[model samples]
Target: MKLIVGNKNYSSWSLRAWLALSLTGTSFEEELLPLDTPEFYERIKLLSPAGRVPVLIDGDLAVWDTLAIIEYLAERFPDAGLWPADPHARAHARSICAEFHSGFPDLRGQFPMNLRREPAPHPKGATADRDTARVREIWTTCRSRAGDGGPFLFGAFSAADCFYAPVVTRFLTYCLDMSETERAYAEAVMAHPLMQAWCADAAKETAVVDADEV
Candidate 1:
């Protein structure tokens, strides 16, 4: 399998797909395209019609969107435990992932994922504030449901973790307020080996996206 991703310093969606793929314990080749560049546009066009990063290619099949890539990986590698085994837990996980996929515009627009940014509080808006509170609520709810299973959202580092991993980075990068529970969950995601590896690689990149630099 070959995965095409964008600049690690700013591509949150790419991180989602990459993390899920990594959890599969599958050998795959990765290609990083510097975002917001002519090269990225030219190269990504051939990979997917969406012209987005995080395209996973397995054999002759190409999965474009982040959620689609994750679903494909989960189906292909059932033993990876990408999603929860319990039907109820799996549905809950998918619900949050879908919410994250289509919602949270305020938080996302105000705080773009930038691993290279120094940790500090950035100014926020009302809707962004509400978004943060909603995220905390989601975390608290997940913890209550899966507290005994493990430290992760659904416990055992499933697709739910991958979906919110970038939000964890956003919280830390912008020094957003987090409760003890939320902080602990964020810490657990950051402490994962794959996430650490991704961060290390992100730190080594020299490319810059001017829009996300703020």
Candidate 2:
């Protein structure tokens, strides 16, 4: 299996799939493309049907989209426990992952993930504020329901945690105001072994996207 992703420092979607793969302990080759570059477009055009990062190639099959990639990984490696074993927990995990994939466009656009950037206050805007509130609510609900297993949303760092890892990065980067529970969750995510590895790799990457540098 092989996973193609964008620059580690800037591609949030790519981070999701990458984290999922890592959590599964799946051995796979990685290819990183610099987003928005001519070379990147050319490479992705031939590599992925959607011309996007986080594309997974397993033998003859190619899967695009972060959620799809994660699903494929889970199905291929059932022992990974990518989703919860309990049916209800699995359903809830899928719902949250789907929500992360499709919802919160305003927060995504306004507070793009840039791991290498220093923390700063969020800019003022009703849309950003509303999105922030929604994110906080989601985090709070997930953690509250997670029981005492740990600080992860699902208590064991499943797909939902992988999906939201980048959002955690965004929150840290922009220094978004978060409740005590949200802050603890963020800290747990940042301190996860896989997350630590990802951050270390990202810190070493030299590719800089100017727009995300702020």
Best by TM-score: 1
Q: Summarize candidate 1's per-residue lDDT along 1-214 as a digit string, tens digits.
A: 9999999889999999999999999999999999999999999999999999999999898999988999999999999999999999999999999999999999899999999899999999998999999999999899988967899999899999998999999999999999999999999999999999999999999988998887
Residues 83-186, candidate 2, lDDT per residue (tens digit)?
Answer: 98889989988998887788888888788888888788868478878888877888999999899887898888999999888999888889888889999999
**lDDT of candidate 1 at residue 35, scale 0 to 100:** 96
Tell me which residue pairs clash in candidate 1: none
lDDT of 2 at 206: 85
Q: Best-fitting candidate, measured by lDDT?
A: 1
lDDT of model 2 at position 150: 73
TM-scores, all candidates, are 0.98, 0.96
What C-alpha lDDT values do all the predictions have?
Answer: 0.94, 0.88
lDDT of 2 at 113: 89
